[model samples]
Target: MTIVATSTSAFYERSRANMKDLRLKAESLQAQVGSGEKLSRSSDDPVAAARLRTLSRLEKLATIDTSNADRASADLSLADSAMSNMSTAIIRAQELATQAASTTLTDDQRAGIATELDEIQKDLLALANSRDSNGHALFGGESSGNAYEFDASGNATYIGTGNSQSLPIGDGQTMDSSMTGPQIFEFTDANGNTTDVMATIKALSEALKGGSTDPTGSANDALASLKSGLDTLSTAQTVVGTRLAWLDTVAERNTNLSELRANEKSDLGGVDMTEAIASLQETLTILQASQASFTKLAGLSLFNNLS
Candidate 1:
């Protein structure tokens, strides 16, 4: 007769696995309470858990990009303020030009006005290469560490990168975080052009201080250029502001998406503490009952030899 085997060890092995599962669940719940997060491990559920991990990393990177954009936006705002000051200086220069145009004014009085305008031009140069939040050049483009320098001839030279630095915000969107000094203050000047608007203004100031009529023509040229420069700066400020606004919208959207992903991740990998605890308690009870039954069975024997 063929007999099938029934092993006492089989029941204990199954019971051991159940006990291990309960212990894991208990620890998982404790971890959730400690971390204030639902999913800490992908082993909870491989598919949904893996996606959550990706989203979490992406969210972190997106936050940093948003911050980068914000800082870039702030630098642009600072540049705009500097440009505003320059605009004021230009207006003052125009007024002085009108005053100097009067035949009644002496050369001495015109010289005083020119002296003040020269100071204004120098201030504008200082503002153009101002630092951003990172102590980097705001208008130095991609090379924030570099600053605009002046040579012995008082010519402005850019020690920065040729390209604008870009930061990725989200969803394949990027923002040009900064502009180089040349883009803002330098221009292609021909024979009559001075190559740099600041230098042109500075030269006009110096020429005017000589009490000579030579600057009258040059000053008119500078005045036109200053107006055009202001228009360009203002337009750039407007564009940067619009991009920041769009980034703000995108950040808001990403925030919502991150939250949703977190919740989905929890749904996928997070064990319900209430249900899990209940299951744990029941498993423990079952284990105790199973152990008692095993003990009782072990103490019994199908055949007792009575010789």
Candidate 2:
């Protein structure tokens, strides 16, 4: 009888271990389904676990790079639009100068065009002071407020700092936070004339209406100056386009890399549901058998056999 009890106790202990294992396996399957991961600990598969950790870190960095790309693209777009507007302003000034050049129009008509140019100048100044989504100057590099400081003499001066702040876009890649006010809207071209579009507009307006006669060569010179301003604006447009295209490539690469990282992470921790189910069923059967055998043996009596 003692032997029978000892054998039964051993069987019971074994059954208990098997049942615990089955419970653990079932829990693991449940976790895999719910959490969408195959392993919860390093003991599950150390190599895969390490790979998953690495991929997760890279994926997070890629996500941040994506955000930077979006912001940079927006800044470039704003600059491009502003440049286009400056070009339109210059074209209008050119037309006005041509009309005023005719010996036919009354001084009143010329003054009228000048008045319109003055309004256009105000509008152009407003554009030069345009802000980005973050409320920073779009053209003034990194200025927080208006980029142009128009003096009492109507001279528009750049009050912004030198370089814009930068955003980290990728591995060893960075984008200028924005173009500075001076870089985009302030400058002197190859000609002695200032290319400050707003300042030019103001000067032309004053020249037209300052009660001066068709100051013989002034209108022609103004047109030439306006053309120079357009050239500067056109060059800026080219730069913006190039930056935007480069950002597009960077954004595409970042997107592809991010997707690759996510895939790698899944591969590292993903489960095979078909295989897991098969293994779980097998473990359940073994545990059931072990429990049944342990129960039967625990009920056996050595006295019966002895008799």
Which one is best on lDDT?
2
Clashing residue pairs in candidate 2 are 140-180, 140-181, 141-179, 141-180, 141-181
Q: lDDT of each structure?
A: 0.67, 0.75
Give lDDT tens digits, candidate 1, residues 247-301.
Answer: 6787688678878877776776565767666665666676577667756755666
Which residue pairs in model 1 clash with each other?
Answer: none
TM-score of each prediction: 0.75, 0.88
